[model samples]
Target: MIYSEKVMDHFQNPRNVGKIEDADGVGEVGNAKCGDIMKIYLKVDDNGIITDVKFNTYGCASAIATSSMATELIKGKSVDDALQLSNKAVVEALDGLPPVKVHCSVLAEEAVRAAVADYYQRKGIEKEIPGCSGNCSCCHLHDEHCGGDEE
Candidate 1:
């Protein structure tokens, strides 16, 4: 399959790779349909802005690209603005993905939301992530990530 130049660039040299031991939030997700997994780490400042972001993904090129692109999009942005990010945006940021690989972009978006939810969970705040629940096409694409077991 033909990949976009941006996709190849991000896949070959993904940004924000690795974990943050004291991160304010961390999120991981997978796509069972293709065994693609993604992990996102975030450092949110007291003002509720994302001071830093990173990701580690084990999957196809699109999966890795989406993860990299997701981190770049959210870093330095407010948590609320980050939540506004969408899978479609992720795909578009990567210059688009193949029809079969669109789910990877969805996974990227979920990784961010899941990590933010984790931050809320850690803070003892009960939060709800819209477009994250129910039987949406992207929601159906999830594989749990907090456990760290790759599938």
Candidate 2:
């Protein structure tokens, strides 16, 4: 299969490749079956500005490109604004991903949202999240506690 030059460049020399040991939030997504896994680390300031972003991913070329591009797109953005990022935007920024590889971009978007959501949860501000009704047990559960009522 053909790959874009940008994709090749990113896959060869991905940016923000390492983990943040004490990140403000960390998000991990994708399963082994999908052939891609992404972990995003973010550092947000008191004003909710994304002061830094980094990622570690294991996947194919398109997945690496998406992770690299997603980090670049979110760093320095407000948490709210960063949460607005979509897979389409990442794909567009990368000059378009192949149809079969689109899932990589989707994973990137989900990783960012998960990180931001974790940040909101840490601050006890889940209600600020768009579309969150603040009623789920997951919203109020304390750190290290599981209140989802699954059991």
Candidate 3:
């Protein structure tokens, strides 16, 4: 499967590849289908802004690229904004992804959301998952909320 130029660029030079020491929130998730894992670190301010974001992903190139892209998108953004970051947006930000690789973006999206969830939990606040469950648009069976576009 062919990847977009943006995907290759980010994968080759992944940003925020390390963890934040004493981070305010941390999230880790694994893709059961691929057996790949992603861990996200976040430093949030009192105002709920994500002052810093970083990720370490053990997966395919798309996983790394999507992780980098997700950090770039959420850094300096509010926790609510970060929660709204979608897998489709991740794929779009990377120009596009092969159908089979679409789930990598989903992993990235979930990682950020999980981090935000952790943040709220620390404050003794409960919040719901902001977006869809991320079934992935690439699969014909799950295209309803998955948004089968560009792919």
| Candidate 2 vs candidate 3, lDDT winner | 3
Candidates in order, TM-scores: namely 0.86, 0.83, 0.83
Quantify all predictions' global Cα lDDT against the true fold. 0.81, 0.78, 0.80
Better candidate number, 1 or 2, judged by lDDT:
1
On TM-score, the stronger of 1 and 3 is 1
Candidate 2, pairs of clashing residues: none
Worst 10 residues of 3 by lDDT: 133-142
Q: What is the lDDT of residue 119 in candidate 1?
A: 77
Error of 3 at 136 (Å): 16
18-135 per-residue lDDT for model 2 (tens digits)? 8889898887776544467788899999999999999998788998899999999999999889889988899888888888888788778878887888877778884354533322
Question: Whole-model lDDT for model 1 versus the true structure?
Answer: 0.81
Sort the candidates on lDDT, descending order. 1, 3, 2
Error of 1 at 62 (Å): 0.6
What are the runs in model 3 whose C-alpha is more than 4 Å off? 31-33, 131-151
TM-score of model 2 vs. true structure: 0.83
Off by over 4 Å in 2: 128-151
Q: What overall lDDT, based on C-alpha atoms, would model 2 receive against the true structure?
A: 0.78
